[model samples]
Target: MNTPSAGTRWIQLGLGLIVMMTISSPQYVWTLFVKPFQATTGSGLPAVQVTFTLLIVLQTFFSPAQGWLIERFSAKGMIALGAALSGAGWAAASQIDSLYGLYATYGVLCGLGTGIVYVGIIGLMVRWFPERRGFAAGVVAAGYGMGAIATTFPISDMIAASGYRHALLVFGAILGVVGFIAALGLRPPQLGETPEIPADKVASAARDVPPKTMLKTPLFWLMFAMMAMMSTGGLMVVAQFAAFSKEFGVADALVFGFAALPFALTFDRVTNGLTRPFFGWVSDNVGRENTMAFAFALEACAIALLLAFRENAYAFALLSGVVFFAWGEIFSLFPSTLTDTFGTKHATTNYGFLYMAQGVGSLLGGPFAAMIHDAAGSWVPVFCIAIGLDLVTAALAWFVLKPARRAYLGVPVPAVPALAEPLAAKPLAA
Candidate 1:
């Protein structure tokens, strides 16, 4: 394949963004279905949320293998298949009334489908814009984060007007067809096709590191630990936001003249989407560890403020957006940071392993958190725990991850942000 011109690469990014947008509704808009599913299935909140947990767990747990599949098959074909499956999962979900049926369709099938599209697109983006991996990844990640902005309010209204089933059937087929068409346009960059222009701020691995070696390193695990901690708090909010909001008395309350739940969701999606690219671009200039520290700290504070003022409906709505804004950048930050640590050669599979941190988090933050909430008789303890995790992870990013990466690279700890030092990864052992 010939080197795609600069414009051609932008076209590639745009296409990936569209495919990303299509799969996003499943994860982001799920809160809307929780009560409805519960009413129909006669299950408790925690049990219904098990469906959400399964969706994330299955999506992430199988990612390493999914990455391998994409590497073996064509990225475009696999991605299209993933999109089709995701759409079908939603459509299938529309017909089901039982908890187990949700487990099969909404949880298992949608998880697998979205996972492939997510991991596949990130893999391609890292290679396509190696120099701007952080920014590129963030843009597409933003698509996933923000994709539901177009759907949340409408889906909420549809459920009110018609029903969840009607809403699911219409949107499922639409998102599936759109994602499939866009995925068809995507392809991996040929060797020497992508630019190698590296700024001092945006670092790259000196050489491509395979998944086995990447897994064995303390540095990778450190990143994983930090990501897992961060993911726990973020995933908790995403999966349980509606539940907690209703308990706080903001779900049906009006905020800015719209129902607080859907309004906050729409606003949260915007901030969530915007943060990915904004932080990704910032990381491209400042440094990944530096960026993580700032964002994570902001997240800790956002959570505390959210809970302290939960009784005021406007505060609940607005502060929830603050929480998401601080939380969502991990999608872009971690993948770019991984490609920078390991090489882009196995970016997909390497990220697949790291992405499992999210699965770990979904377990902790999803059903487990809900169980905790039920046992504790309030959401206060859950929010407090999430706050603590955010602060600890933020400290690790600057003090721990910074020094760890520098030591792994065998570079002296400069007074500067350590990982930002020039990196020349050692070649893989023969």
Candidate 2:
């Protein structure tokens, strides 16, 4: 196959972003649907909450499967399948009256569909910008966060005007159309299509270690822990932010959910997405450790503000922006760090394992935060917990990450063995 032009590569990225973006809107906007769905079915809070919780549970399960598919098929194929399922799930969900059917279709099926698509999109972006992993991944990942910001308000309005079932059907149709079109545009870069490097350059980059050897290193564990901690805080925000704002002071908390959309998208696309590339570029020079340390520190300051102030809109906005921005960078930073510290041969699998750590962190964070709020009857404790974790993340980034990057860069040739132990078996390549 002929190599794709730079423009074609970018177009593929954009299309992948759009597809991923659509898959996310339903999940993020769940609160809007919850009340109406309850009324429509004459079901109580338990039923509605179960639907939401089940969706998340399904998401966690499907992530690994999604990663597997990306290796076997191209990003486009996986995404197209995912998109079709998601659309069909939502459509079926709209027609269902029983909560069980809702859980099976919307909760299980749609969640799995989105999970598969997410892995493909992230993998694709990392491959496309191998040299600028942070920025490229941020741009694609940001589409998820940003889309919530962009769609939630208009979606809320539609829900109010047309009722929840109708809103879902309309949205499902839109996702189907947009997702199908976008999926058509995805194509992987052929080998040698990537930028060229001379033989001497490759030799000079070699190291003493072998592939799969790096798994035994302390550096890998530290990076994994650091990723887990950083992700915990961000996932906490995504899971609880709407409920937090709604519970605290906002009269129309749902409206504020839409309101927060702007900051979510802008901070992700602009601060996180844009800054990620810049940070990754800087990592090439100043070092990944230093660049990530700065990002983690930035996150600490944001979390601190939330702990210090309670329910203040401005404080909430600032904290939310920081959370989104840093959250965007976490995945972006990991791929390059893995490629640099390990090697590109197993980059995708390594990334998948690393992402599993993130998923674990998120899974832990949601319930942990809920416990804190339930016991304390306020979000202050939750914020305090996040701040503490952010501090740990900062320290890990500064100490462990810095030294690892230094060692990686100092080596003339990073042997595949040196990379082996540090990486888990990775997902398939984008």
Candidate 3:
């Protein structure tokens, strides 16, 4: 098999970015739809919110199977199928009259669709840029993180102008078509294709560890727990921000001449997008665990500040962006670290198992967080729980994840040299 030129790989990256961006609004812009759905269905907040949890759970829990399918089939075809499902899910959702219908359409269909494109593209990016795994992954992850920024206000306006149903139908078709067209152009790098990197920058793993072998490793499970914990904190904010903002009487307040909720949401999206690449680049040079520790700790602090001053609109908006900026890098850091540790041969499948942690996080972060707020009659306990989880995860990233990964790979602290080192030149075991 022939390896494509750098230019060709970059083009593939661009297409993956487009596909990711198109599908991302479904997740990120979901908060905007929550109130509308609840009003339309007359379901309480917790019941309406369960759809969000269902979406994430299905999207994440089925990723390993989705990854396996992508690996065994045409990447383009699988992505196209996913795009169709995602778009159709939204379109179908616009006509649903009940929560169960919403779950079937938006939760199950869109979840499965996004899962397929997400894992397939990440795997493709990892394969295409073996030497720049973090950056490549970050670039694509940014599309998912920030994609909704372009549409959030538009959807909000459409909901206000026409209705949620109309907004869903129009955007669903556009995103689906765009995603499908872009997916049609995606091609995974040929097997055994490797990018050239400096000898000192090779990853620690000497050979690809099959997914089965990776599943049994303590390193993988520890990383899974870490990912879940980090995910819970971030996702809690993502799914519940609008609710909290409303409860605090700041949702409609003005921040810098813009509505506080939309302004904060847009700002959060930008910071969220920027953090993926920024931290991914940082991880490439400084080390993944170090970057994780820094970003996670920053998130913990931001959450605490938000809880302290949340009633103030300006503080709420600013701190929300900070919280997201600190949180979003997990999307980039985890995948790069996983591929770095386990090898890229089975990256799509291996990351699938790890990605399930996001589903677990969603269960904890989405519905559970909402339930906590309801039970306590305040967002205070929710914020406190999130803060504690963030701090604990940050500590574990450095103290536990770092040392365990080093021992698993038999490398020293700060394992930068091994990633770019020539595969055949190293004596490390698979």
Candidate 4:
């Protein structure tokens, strides 16, 4: 296969973004459907919420197999199949009357579909933009993080007007079609080829490290632990935001003339999307561990404040956005960092293992957190656990991840090259 030009690679990136955006709403807009599903099915909160856990678990845990499939099959074909499954999942759920039906359709099918699109796109981005893995991954990840902003209110309104069934059918078809078309446009970078970069550009890794080798590294496991910790907190919020908002007595309150819940969800999506690229760019310049520590610490603070002042409508909205902003960077940070450390030869499959941390996180954050709230009669203990995880993860990023990566790289810490530096004839292996 011929190498794609920079322009062509960027166009592919744009297509990946659209694919990601279309598939994102299933995960992000789920909270909006919780109450409606509960009312319709007459299920308890815990039983109804298990679908969310199932959604995240299958989405993440199956990613490695999905990633391996992408490597062995046609990227376009796999993505098309994924899109179809994702759309059909939601559309089929509209007809289901039982929780098991939901688990079969929305939980299983949507999870598998989203996982395929996510892994495929992230893999494509790192290959196309090895010189700026963080930024490239961030741009696509932003699509997933921010995609729901455009649909949250619309879904809410639809659920209110036509009921959740109609909303699911309409949006599911739209997402499936759009995602299918976009997936057709995606192409992987040529094997054994790297994008040309300036000689002075900061190289992420000296050479490619196979997935097996990467798994053997202690650094990978440490990063995994940190990612799981971070994911637990953010996902707890994502899965339970609506419940907590109502619990705090601010779900119906107004913020800036808009209902607080939707307003916060929208605002959180924006900050969530923005932080990926913002911190990705920062990491490309400042270093990964430094960025991780900063973002995680910010999340720790935000979650604490959110718990403390959640009853206040304004504080609830603002602090929720802050928490997401800090937390969402993990999507960009961990993937880029993994590729940076392990190299991109098996990025899709390698990152798949790491992505399972999110599955672990979903288990901890979703049903487990909900169970905690039920037992405690408060969200306070859950929030405290998240805060503690954040602070500990932040510390590990600096003290553990930083030194570990350097030792693995066998180099002293080095500064990123300035943009003014001349372009190199050969590209970096990362």
lDDT of each: 0.87, 0.66, 0.86, 0.85
Per-residue lDDT of candidate 1, residues 152-223 (tens digit): 788889989999999998899999999999999999887777776443445566778889989999889999
Candidates in order, TM-scores: namely: 0.90, 0.80, 0.89, 0.89
**Candidate 3 lDDT, tens digit per residue, 254-313?**
999999998997788889999988988878776788788888999999999999998999
Q: Write the per-residue lDDT of candidate 2 for residues 1-430, one digit (tens) a residue.
A: 2344667667867887798788877677777777767776788987777776666655655565576666766667777888878777787888888778778878887877777777677767766655555566766766765566667777788878887778788888888778877887887777766553222221112332332565677777778788888778767766687678677664232325555444443444445545555565555444455567777777777767755653566566656666666666776677667655665544445566566666677677888888888999988778777777877787777655654555554532234332112221222222
Ranking by TM-score: 1, 3, 4, 2
Model 4, position 125: C-alpha lDDT score: 92
* Model 3 residue 15 distance off true place after TM-score fit, in angstroms: 0.5
Root mean square deviation (Cα) for candidate 3: 3.4
Query: What order do you get sorting by lDDT, best first?
Result: 1, 3, 4, 2
Across 255-345, the per-residue lDDT of candidate 4 in tens digits comes to 9999999899789889999999888888776677888889999999999999989899999999999998899899999999898777777
Q: What TM-score would you give candidate 1 relative to the actual structure?
A: 0.90
Give RMSD (Å) of candidate 1 vs. truth: 3.0
- How many collisions between residues are there in candidate 3? 8
Specify the highest-lDDT model's number.
Answer: 1
- Candidate 2 residues lying further than 4 Å off, grouped into runs, are 1-6, 197-220, 242-285, 342-346, 405-430
Stronger candidate by lDDT (1 vs 4): 1
Model 4 earns a TM-score of 0.89
